[model samples]
Target: MHSINDAAGKILSSRQTVALTGAGISTSSGIPDFRGNNGLWKTYNPSIYAHINTFRSDPALVWELAFMLHDLAASTAPNEAHVALAGMERSGLLQGIITQNIDSLHQRAGSRNVINYHGTVDSAECTFCRIGEPVRRAALPVCSICGRTMKPGFTLFGEPVPPSAYLEARNLASYSDVFMVIGTSAVVQPAADLPFIARENGAFIIEMNSEETGLTNYITGCFIKGPVEQTLPLLVNKLNRRN
Candidate 1:
């Protein structure tokens, strides 16, 4: 891991800097980081909603996921890291943020250039109709039109990422000069591959995770081992001081 001062300065100096965030960034906000040994995936039986087969079998799983998501978003507020990243966007130091988190804290933090890779829980979509409709669940999910069923606007485990969101994230990673990966475990596929893709695209990789990850060995630029709340604010402050 590189020194914070050194990493922050250089990454801030980058012209077209961007970030790819994961659940670790929101763990502090109370949404448990999934995929860890005791994460949501491991502790709970996830077929309820995170899989296409389960959803097809019982559309109620979609409603279950939706309610859980609604409660999470309703409870967890954006933390310091989210605010700092939003500030970075406002300052023009960061071009955009691509997040794997389904929670919409980044939007609440006032981030403008954000591409949510996993869809959002803020809105629900009809699984049967697929009409790109907006249906909010005040209590439970019952589609007004088809009255079939509705689910969160996110990708299930067996489903592919949304093409529009995927393209936007890929484009940002491909063109970015500095790739800031914050608080991600970097174990998941496709989402984890973005940093490697960014490196292949001739960009500097700066990882800010609480501990070592699979990407650690490949980070030729910098690696800051600490929580995002501690690291991002300092980085933002470092950039703020430069002006």
Candidate 2:
């Protein structure tokens, strides 16, 4: 088992990397992680809010929940980890970022090659036609072009993953030389499966998590066991030094 600093060195040495991020990456930005005490898991059941079924059935709460989260997200900014990822992308080592988080922090940090597996919390769409448009936090966010209910451009639990986003994440993972899994426990489906696919296609797997994410065994590559904000900056600095 390598210490945090040693793992950072090896990560910066790798090329053709694809990052897999989870809630932990954004927790520093005031977003709540699901597993921790103050996380969503401790606060609410996932089955209640992860899908449209809950929204359609009880919309009052859906919008209420949205309002709260959106209000919170509005004030949050990108953390050091996010900036470091953007810096890595600028150096052209990062091929893409596969994130389970709905927060747009990675994109905001200037990373253009992000694959938002869970979709973003910003944009909205017409539920019926699936045509998307930007939405603001007005008293009512209705569609001007179409007369349909406007919902956030995210995958509700029962909904299928958006094809374009899903395929892009898989393709990047498939061709990556290194799959960097960060802040995720590796228990989630689909996104969890992505690293395995990459590994099968000859990608090295690196995991970073504070807890035992159940993936430490399969990933023979480096594991930086610390907070992302503390760890990613160090890795990015190492990458800067190598040149």
Best by lDDT: 1
After superposing candidate 1 on the true structure, give the runs of residues whose Cα lies further than 4 Å from its correct spot.
Answer: 133-135, 138-140
- Model 2, residue 61: distance off in Å is 2.4
lDDT of 1 by residue, 1-243 (tens): 487787767766688898999988999998887776768777446765578787778767666766777777888899999999999888888899999998989999999888989888777777678755554656556677898667668888788888889888888999988998888866677787788788999888888999888788766578888889988898888878874
- Give lDDT for model 1: 0.82
Worst 10 residues of 2 by lDDT: 1-10
Clashes by residue pair, model 2: 50-157, 51-157
- Tens digit of lDDT per residue, candidate 2, span 116-160? 897777877777777776657775456677775677776777777
How high is the CA lDDT of each candidate model?
Answer: 0.82, 0.78
